[model samples]
Target: MPALTLSRGVADWPEQGYDGWVLLGMVTLSLLPVIRLFLQTLNAGSIEVAGVSLSFAAASESAAEAVRTATLTENLDTPEDMPLERTSLRSILRALRRAHDSEVTVVDLRQGQTWWETRLFILIAGAARRDRTQAIAFVGERNGTPGTFLGWAPPSRLLAAHLRSDPLLSAAHERARAKTAAWQLGQPLPNPHASVTPSVMLPWGTNQSLPPVENQTPDPAFAFELYLQQNLDRPSPESGRLVTIQRLRELYEVFLVTDSIDAQTPDDAWAEVVLTASPRRFFAVTKAGKFKALIPRDALVAALVTRLVRAEDSPS
Candidate 1:
């Protein structure tokens, strides 16, 4: 009986030690998160916040000063039908680089505050090829903002009005335009989008299904394809002068009519506008101007116009 009692006691002692070890482990696990938090707080405290300014700030100021020094007419007057000799962009880039005394080269200058780097070359080429005029703005991803501007069009008249209405993008445009050389006005250059001016506006329509003709015309289908490809940034239909669903239906037959095209379905809405004829061609009739069927690329004409209007109307 004594031997049995001793054996039972020994077993009980082992159980107690095992329980103590489990308890100690639980305590350690509970405190670990708190210790981690304390260390993070200490590290955060070591970083000092200072009110540092960018060197570009001074460059921006100087650039603005140069622009303001001239009279409004002299400064604002842009030339008409100016064709790009080399890239007019080069002059502006050089000017900005000189003023800033930094490596600040011209990224894509499509709209206000928003610009692009070299990554957007294909997009720029596509935009330039599609537009005959009023395609000045460069659509590029820059500084986390997606925007537009008059890349080829002179910053005058209707273009100015569009800029005034769009507060967000227009402000950036104002800054960029101010920094640019005054001579860019009348030069024929690449336009990113249409301007409000009737002379420069190019309308895009989805009405590609025009009546059949004897000779086949080269479809401008690539225009819309290019437009869609470059416009990865999902712009809001209500952001600026966006075409309403009803208006779009009435005007063009094709569209990606959603707040964000990049987002997935059931939110996705895309449609194509084909001509009434066989192997349907694309054409859109607009009050601005006729985007001929020879260039199926004209399908994006209205869309680009709408995008420009939206950018011009949006506030910073």
Candidate 2:
């Protein structure tokens, strides 16, 4: 038998086809483990594979956990028995920063006050500053309180500022005020839930036999009017005729007129309105043109008809 000669050229590889197929099979089998390991690493929270490391799930979970913790702390009332920790201040600040743009109802729980006795505030401007030393600036209105207050309180004191999806008891409060106003004015009490003035009076007084006043024409202009309990602090030319701002441009105009007319006006007059901070309550600084006079937000007889807006033609 002649001695076998080995061919080294590329074209001669097919001659070793059986050995080549076996080598290819072994290489593919070896790579399958690496591919599976890569997939596993991707799915895992934290894993090291073949000199590479991944922590996708771990990082995501950490962020999610922080938010959940903050939310839980905010919603649940702090245990009366448990003492507050100094370290928790950092977490509170973090939560405030996250919820900066949103309004919150802060429940101050000190001095063993019961749930009803505990001071409640609707806080705006959630976090004042980023520094630990800085006090959080807030415009807060306590429940059943007459005036809106401006205060700089430590973040730690804001123990449970629960985020609310709706205006804080605004509709109910407005309806209650409207009913009271109608009784005082001797007009028919409007429907509790009706936005528009009702055609018929729902009998509501000590004696339910009061006759409905005839020829009552509800003025369309004053349809959204709020009957305030007290007059605004600032006096203007149109103050007595006014009942509510009614529009953004009107508010801007009223601010201008008041600032010009009032002797004791702040340099930044708009800041006064901002301090009220409740969306449902428009701070009528002064009155103008059949609009309601300003009073504390809590004393308003109806929900604010107009929202704060940036009007193109608004006075500077």
Candidate 3:
């Protein structure tokens, strides 16, 4: 009876065609890895603050000059809900207007559409110095919202550490500082954001899913990667381990924006960059690149850093 039972069980296996089922299961398992890889590739997206692609093309010499003039003339530490001395503001508006021969137009990159008739407010703060770093906090939406974006000049080493881990931001901050510094130094600002990197603006139209001309133009993406590497290559004040992409993504929204989706895509105009420095934060934007200068993102940050240090050294 025992032998009969064993033979019956074995006989049922063939009757059920267990080998066929086994082969089918193996095939499914074998394809899973490939399927997963394909899905990952398909879902690839972009990373940009407030929906604007962080690229060199976004930077313009005239735009940077305009920003420099505005920053120099405007009150960098003006409080919200209060009107500052009109002299500087009017002068800034005049210079910017004459420089570009038009009214100032603030473009909300997050909305993907131009805010043609609305007014926008942006603030600039100072950054920490090596010997006496200030303690500034960033306000607004840290997760991804857009509101008063801020910039700061973190010491070079700290900036580099952030880069090895967070290439996108590191790239943005680096390029911004470099260009802005050049502008302040009376040197011609370069288009550092032009290096190719994947980015998707917020409020992107339905058709604006992946990067524009992604497959057709891979050079930009490669350029972005190179720009990021360059961030690491630069001299820094301190040294630390390189951060993984995942870790950097965690700190992605550190820019501290006030809201999200201020504009929409394809037909949008205007681009804004925020600088966050300890005890100080600021933002720079281009009214219209067609007739203006590139917003100096990095240079603004570095300037803020220097400003913050100077402020701290001054009497309270």
Candidate 4:
């Protein structure tokens, strides 16, 4: 049997595995700038300011002046909503050309379609390459806020590869490769919801029809596992843990949302969310890559049940 080692502070990751601290740390690091800038924007309310990007900026009309960020917008259009087709992006490029004549342009990587997961990235790259006038830079978002800045496509490929090859992103990348293989080779997709790990999304219920566990009370976690199998696009389960009723308790706090999805392939955009409930009871984690960001599924059923009971008990 192979040995399993786990560490909270260990930054070294295997080709495929989970590290709680790594996940949390990566997110925390990305969040620092977002927190600081958000504070600056809030404090700007009391002070006098002219039209500017944020309270941090002074008016400058130079070509290198502002780095327009898409995620900074309150209602950012998710990749699902964007028209990223090559032809469409080309049209946007032409339109942008006529409107703004500048030495450089900063575009959301999501819109540029150059991020690894987007099917249009390679296509978007061609367009970006052909643009003779303007140089481009890309920015990635964290928790609906902008932070990580991936530079222009031509130079950033190696850096992007390094970041995306990490355990979590690799899981998404591996899945994309498999689906691509299955499509090109016409191989049997034994499980359409297939993943590199036993996913929290649970796609096995269709193949497994075992009789109920005899004389045992229904386990919410087990039941939830079964529930997830019906949808294969959901996030894969974390390594080193079984989905148990006891495990599901972490997500039982009051929450305004109840949804989540896991990235299993390369074509979907990637995002991870951490919702720390009031008073630090526990944190709820959710992610969407190659799909819409959803509420966490690990504790979703429990959270929903909590909400329903609370709603029903209130005075009618």
Candidate 5:
């Protein structure tokens, strides 16, 4: 509860002309929000300030007696919903701390709200910078309206598009993004189902898997790795570029991702490009630039081009 002080001898309310009504009006407005806050807390047994909801649920009496409180039950895994207006990183971090306890926190993102999406992007990224490792689950309605659950799984592109601007994560983001582009472009995407982008798009790269590789000489998909191993002693990523390759009167794109070898000085930013036929397929390119046996199977260089062109010409 709060109080508003009235100035004495003010021209707006001179002492002689003052009535109790004016004071009462000012007091009512001041106390209204406090009353609402108090009522909300009383009803929910939780304290909310600045849109972050913090609620503590005590362990069940029966469970307590058995001393079996190691992890929460699935039925009790309810996500604390955040307020729609200006959910701050501090608030999200607070909710995350609560989530480490018995409650999960869910940020409800409305459909097509670019403003909220951008804000959420910053929040998730900030969480990443802080090394927060919790799966961020968002609840979104279909077409921003009342609807049945189309299914629990949403499109991978839904997150990929939103997360494309991350310069820090572009290396990882590009892996799954390549798959998305391959599928949409009707290119040879051997591992479309093996997507880490949806989770990568969020702040959680909580799992690590060995990058797939081919050992045989001239595995064109790994031309970049071979070149790096041969030329550099200690290699590091520098920059990545996408190149359009046309052969036999057909055009295709390859991501010419680059890396810097060990350098002795600050000017050691010299870089070399690694060629990949698909997003995930990194092939080795020789000084001669020949990729005979290295090209991926079932993805014949020229035939695949036709599918890509057809996919592009198709109506959205």
Candidate 6:
């Protein structure tokens, strides 16, 4: 009902009572070309939007150049019979060990954890192999200084370690040990296998030659102690909070480790290993902090190994 004025020296329109809807439509149609031009400018590289100028093309080129310059390692050559899962685990461990003293971003993806979906930048102060598995002893870094030592093991291994130390299982374990000894000496096993009939074959066969069982179960406390002994020569922080192995295990149990995309490109070999292995859980050797890092879920496992390996291979 009121006369409408258009900006940019356009004449005021009072025709048709200056219908607001028509004016709105006309304004939107006029903006279509400007919107198209803005998008084209963005794709062309440098562009200003909302008073902020950005050089997307240059940023992309810089990232590509960084990837090109990164030091990369050749895929590990392993025996055909060796499981790729084990190989990938080994690769990750090797990378962490090599990347010691370097910083990395760790994101906690575990639901309901203290830092769930939080990212922390941690320095890999040190790493030690534990009990021949893919487990490692990690040193916590804070404010660029190493403070506490922690141990990490696979979930199953950690559970087994705890079960071995459980007071309730002591008596049962001892009795089982005695029975195992008796069986090794050709004694009959209990219950279902107690009365061996001619139809049923003995578990150890007629020769009673049972395969040797190697007890290499990882012990977190022992591993921590070993780590401490290894670092005995290093000076301890004058004042820092000491963390228990149990607490460390509890914290690490819920988290998975991966490399930040900014660190390195995901390794195809490592990706293949992950695809073949299909591991449901992973752990990182990192310090506790509020640092942040990101990696695609699919690239999670591959990135850590590849980045660390690249860091190690990279010339200082």
Q: Candidate 6 regions off by >4 Å?
A: 1-139, 142-159, 166-266, 276-280, 283-316
**Candidate 6: tens digits of C-alpha lDDT, residues 58-152:** 23233333221111022223443332223422333333334332222221212112210000001111222122222222334434443232333
TM-score, cand. 4 vs. native: 0.22
Task: Tell me the tens digit of each residue's lDDT in model 1 across 183-239.
Answer: 122233343544311111122311122111123321222322222222322253322
- Misplaced by over 4 Å in model 4 are 1-102, 110-134, 153-316
lDDT of 1 at 246: 33
- The candidate that achieves the highest lDDT relative to the unseen native structure: 6
In Å, residue 232's CA in model 2 sits off its true spot by 41
Q: TM-score for every candidate vs. truth?
A: 0.16, 0.17, 0.18, 0.22, 0.20, 0.19
Give a tens-digit lDDT track for model 2, residues 164-221: 2123323322443464445445445455643444433434534211222123333221
lDDT of 5 by residue, 1-316 (tens): 1122344433434354554676767776776565445434434444333443322111111122222111211212332243322332333333334433321123333232312222333333333323332223233334434211111111122234335543433443444334333333332223345432211221232332223323211232222222222222123231221111111001101212221112121111111111122342212111122111111111222222233345456665
In candidate 3, stretches whose alpha carbon ends up further than 4 angstroms from where it belongs are: 1-65, 68-139, 142-151, 154-158, 163-213, 220-316
Q: Against the correct fold, how does model 3 do in TM-score? A: 0.18
Compute the lDDT for candidate 3.
0.31
Q: How do the candidates rank by lDDT, highest first?
A: 6, 3, 4, 2, 5, 1
lDDT of each: 0.27, 0.29, 0.31, 0.30, 0.28, 0.31
lDDT-best of 1 and 2: 2
RMSDs, each prediction? 27.2, 28.3, 27.6, 24.4, 30.4, 24.6
Against the hidden true structure, what lDDT does model 1 obtain? 0.27
Tens digit per residue, CA lDDT, model 3, 88-188: 22222332233232212222222212111001111110121121222111212223554333322223323344455534444545564453333233422
Cand. 5 Cα-lDDT: 0.28
